[model samples]
Target: MSTLGWWRLIYAAFAGFLLFHGFSASENAPNYSFMHNATSAPFLSYYDYIVVGGGTAGCPLAATLSHLANVLLLERGGSPYGDPNITKLVNFGASLSDLSPWSPSQRFISTDGVINSRARVLGGGSCLNAGFYTRASPEYIRQAGWDGRLVNQSYEWVEKLVAFEPHLGHWQSAVRNGLLEVGVVPFNGFTFDHINGTKVGGTIFDEQGNRHTAADLLEYANPRGLTVLLYATVQKILFRFRGRRSRPEAYGVIFRDGSGIEHRAYLKYGFKNEIIISAGALGSPQLLMLSGVGPVAHLKAHNIPVVLDQPLVGQGMCDNPMNAVFVPSPIPVEVSLIEVVGITHFGSYIEAASGETFSASVTTTSRNYGMFSPKIGQLSTVPPKQRTPEAIARAVEYLDNLDQAALQGGFILEKIMGPISTGHLELQTRNPDDNPSVTFNYFQHPLDLQRCVQGIQTIGKIVESESFSKFRYDYMSWPGLVNMTEHSPINLLPRHYNSSIPLETFCRDTVMTIWHYHGGCQVSRVVDPDYKVLGVEALRVIDGSTFNYSPGTNPQATVMMLGRYMGVKILRERLGN
Candidate 1:
């Protein structure tokens, strides 16, 4: 079926169901009143706590906080529950490639010429990403100074709602054995805990292939105390100035609703009433900077008024670098995402995606639209001051290349789990609707490049193993268009392994982001151990942005755990339990 046909069918199915049966009033059923368009509703006078960006952390945090106090949760995008494009596991790539302004996954290009997207939906990355889920390593919890017992409990709270063990198919099974052949030792079997070995961990997609995201955690929310506003774009955090030298205190938030109507949600009279910024790595920092809490120099450049002048808000951005080897199978493989992952000894991770490749029709349409034309201008939302035409061109070209490459079948992803290189995010324009200027600075350090090279080498070994040899005829030098001899003995290692320069060049050309961005609002720098932003009162940031370092795994689970941990901490502090 065509995309439009599929959408119409989905809409009809949902509408018919809703018409026949009214929404359920059970605790697990989402409250219809809570999920409303902000433009139509009366302005809320006050909320004991306001959580911005109803995403991975925001959803869970707001739900937890609502138990004790009146809470308002604001999300920029519409609900993810009924969106077939988001709830279906097969439409994962389509979710990210969606270019509509209201798309849950907002596509953007980094300053370093990488095309990527961040979740604008209620469930955040969990709604758009490759659905792989794993718990943070014990070392990660220790490193972050989290109470070991509390962290374990937090993981359980999140897992019980959104996570499930995946049933590995033929291709996934082959991947498992291949990893073992590559010496990624003792299989830990199916489990969620992050251990040093090959293992099949939990996935957000359930047995029926329906994706459960962080938004599902809101099922536990206290309906009487929780109010969720969709399409509520938070423009800035409102603060009350005391004196020239006195610290600024957060009082409320200034936001625009779906119809471009502005609304204010303020903190109630209690001293403990607070505002939490749960936007992801890029978003949290951008919101902070927009609220005048970033480096004074950057704010001045954008002509934004400074409030706190804290220099660390948007700094320390880091993302895992990923490279892939596409193997086009003549025989069809079962559709799957990351079911079995290889935690290699070389500080890298190996995962694979199997199913139909992205169609060639997409590339044809893109080319016809003159993507390469010199007249193709930069995105209008990108301000003239921050626009880099060359970078934009390079990013567009890379996307074109990637689309063309994806037309062929089988997919394997090799990622540098712990990269030494880092990047930063800054505002492009003062407009909250505009995307931030992101610089992942991928492979900037020599060690990062070497790690990627090692990862690719490991993947080559896995593919060459006897377990994967059955699909040998399916091998292609690259995706879509074949560059080398058909099915000739695959060897990326012999040529590139011994030579560093060629390997580096290959990595530079093919390396892309796995979308595991973290550490923009880093602990000890932007927020304290308690997750509160420095030099600010009644404000905290509790998302992936607050990660001290990358958790060295798929971060969706960790991000959810952080929300649970923060929620419990806030409750404990408030109730004096």
Candidate 2:
């Protein structure tokens, strides 16, 4: 058991760090440049561009913008504490299933009432994401509703940072190869999982070295101008309330250092400059709401001042409900089970030379011929408006095929259901530190529920086929759709059998998250197309929160692109010279 003193130590250490490294606006302050002349009207900390939430989007934008402007990055978590929990990327088998040990330092889990994830430590999610690399497809990029400018810019930008190298490690089995050869992994005709650009299995991400994080990418991009201030959390966006007639312009940001000392960091002073918010979908909207920037009704209920009347600030949020199938491989087990599980996880990356992360996933490739493929004929392509009976029927058939294959792949999983998008981030209290009321709201969306069923069905289909006939496995899933729990129920005394559950609900119950949360400060639909919070000036959101909806895959890469694009927009507007 962890002691209360331990928590005190962690808390104290964080506080001390802020007093020393954060702004003081005094001669004794730690703003290296201001030590000689600290008494200034501008205060202890100021910047041309101040980025909050130094995670995936924040770090990159801060780093990029620093090249042309002064950047100050504020994070809520302590820096370089060297906690292995937040440093190493491990999400295979048991690691992925269990959360207690991995995300122990996490302060926030559900971003809003929507996501069910935790990565508040120094490196944030980038420290632990299975560095699956996904280069934006031109088609998918365009589909994001951005003009060609953003997509082309992102591709050009990513290509500069994404330095992919082939992982020459020997494969334990030909599962990935066999799947790729069979057109299951390929989208167009090639695979995108390989960092080395080949049809290989288990692209080793770490490359037997230190892990690469989003912080790494930012630092790598502009090592000179970047100053990462960890343990500093942005409390509010400073606004000069200019009454009802004119738009309230953003002055800068108010943040709390680790020790809980408050300070302000200004964006380059001008009435025209903007305050870019890239603090993930959850954080961005939550901050917006706290600052009286969401639905007037909701803000009033929380006693939060309504800075803006954006009703959709937190609405229209969605994330991909990821389902994982852990396969038990017996093909000459070279590494120990612990080692094997530690490796081979999803999207694991090792930083080589700045491009994408380390070992990446074979994602969005020409080889992936499944639903992610660009092909329309093979999918239930009906738009959100049309959920025709025929479409539902076809989806059910597809579901049957997807679930079986997942099981046959030698999955080392026990729980295969219960993940619902019903989870949402609601204000638990007036306190910012208080955990939000979370509801998965899983099986909430008819179409999303259908997709979950299809994923399970497709995996099952693969298991039933001759592709996995030799690997005999039990039909162990939820009660109605598959089989009964062979062993004891997970942490139970007297478990009841859910035998009569309907197939649809059973399939719904079988759905779980892939842990990809996105779409909070939604774009075009939620915020303005330029990502500005409607009715607010000098304030824009550019992060996973800006996603229109969960893009059906890992959102980090996309969010990074958004941060870059938004930074570029901010740069071009004021400092375009």
Candidate 3:
């Protein structure tokens, strides 16, 4: 209350602001930011490590390795800015192939024309993916020929550094609890094991509700040693025979960027010792063979010089195959961990990594019985066509009618959970400068069909459960707008229809890819137990492509751990025996 007190307080506030500015400025004499192209990007003929494919695996690998070595990370895409479609993590994650700009670009086209575009930009696939850390099932890991050791369970160590925290607001919190009241469970499988279950809750987000990507971790790295070259496409691998009649030695990397300008990422930039390729499954093999290190016949087809007669540069690929089943509900209007607790408990994940809206979810799923989904061919058979538009209209109207009846009977449709699943990743080319040709081959396996059938049946049973006896299903798409395209209530089940509403006899429709594309470069099929390319020297892959079998779940988290593990291996390799 004294005049002297007011004067003292004002002086203290002024002093505090000045002190803050002084400390911030002193940390860096002239702060150089990569976001601003700080100094025209340092390029040279030599660098300690030339990491090709500044992708999900490559970026983190480069950042971590740069802690002790000078590293050059080369990416094929342009800068991370100006692309509102890609930079906005939320929309970017949910963005379907149709809406994605990269989908139709020449960079993503395959010679065989089945569209599959997983990011070709600076941040790599993370830029286009939802941020779930889904790992493999035990069955998946064993099939991939990996010891359980490959799955990292040290969340404290990893999260402490990266802080994989969730960004749950009040609305999201309500959804989480409500999902538990329903039967949906968390997925705690062989991986995504949150050290103490903190990771099990829901969509993983940064403190600001933004998705945290591998690129976001660069701040944790010692920036002085890392050089990220965006818009640079690797053209070839510089290598030679180490001894008379011996395998070739990998020396460095050569790349041609967007402008057709050529540059070399030498191993001498930091300490000039080794190289690593984190270019994912497709890109990695393409680069390897382009530099003369793949199947001889394939290389010749691509008109590339055969450096090594390696037969398996791009074979034995695997990825998680999935089909998202939608259920309509208004009460539970957002994503929920309790709804997916079974998978969460198993580290099977649900991620906000996509940072999209509630309706735009990128979650992985599987049955509790440890079974895969049905093969594509064995799914629903073609039914006779509905006789007329009126008949078709009636059929869809009945689905609406049944939905209402179910609501009156106190239940919801639950989820689609079709019982079948299978994923195969196959390569289509050997061009190092281009993205690899790969396929999901989902629903191609027999058991996949059975799984889908079981899922649908389970959903029917849940909707009919006594737990939902109070609310009206209005089957008119209870949770979400399920009636978006009705025509359900097929008489295949044993449920009684109070109203003798006739089901539409004909309904065969095509569905677009839910964008859960995964598994192209298989683990054992592509490399040996140590993840070596079966025959290449000084090269290894540590990305999603390294997966051995598809768990039909989200594969991003597993891919990240693989990258982290590879970085450790590559770093150890550089240290020498």
**RMSD values, in order shown:** 6.9, 12.1, 12.9
Q: For candidate 1, what is the TM-score?
A: 0.85
List TM-score per model, in order: 0.85, 0.68, 0.66
Write model 2 residue lDDT over 220-246, tens digit each, in one string: 345455556655557778777677588
lDDT of 3 by residue, 350-419 (tens): 2211011222223212110000011101111112122233443454344334433232111111111221
By summed lDDT, the worst window of 10 consecutive residues in model 2 runs over: 349-358
The stretch of ten residues in a row with the least summed lDDT in candidate 3 is 367-376
Q: What is the lDDT of residue 217 in candidate 2?
A: 49
Model 3, stretches more than 4 Å misplaced?
1-44, 79-115, 134-157, 161-202, 269-272, 330-332, 335-341, 344-435, 461-472, 476-521, 550-553
lDDT of each: 0.75, 0.46, 0.45
Whose lDDT is greatest here?
1
What tens digits encode model 1's per-residue C-alpha lDDT throughout 1-577? 5463355335434533542354432223354546666655466569999999899899888888889999999988767765666776655565565565666888777787666678888888888877889998988888889999988898899989999999998888888999998798879999898898899988999898778899899987888889888778899999886787778899999987765667888998996889999988888999999999999999999888898888878888887877766565545677788888888787888888776523232312343111111112222122223335564455446445544324223567678876788888889999887899988788899988888888888888887899887654543443433533322211123234656546666677655667787878989999899988899989999999987567747988988888888999999999983
Comparing 2 and 3 on TM-score, the stronger one: 2
What order do candidates take by lDDT, descending?
Answer: 1, 2, 3
Residue-level lDDT for 371 in candidate 1: 12
Better-scoring candidate (lDDT), 1 or 3: 1
- Residue runs of model 1 more than 4 Å from their true location after superposition: 1-33, 243-245, 357-409, 474-496, 499-501
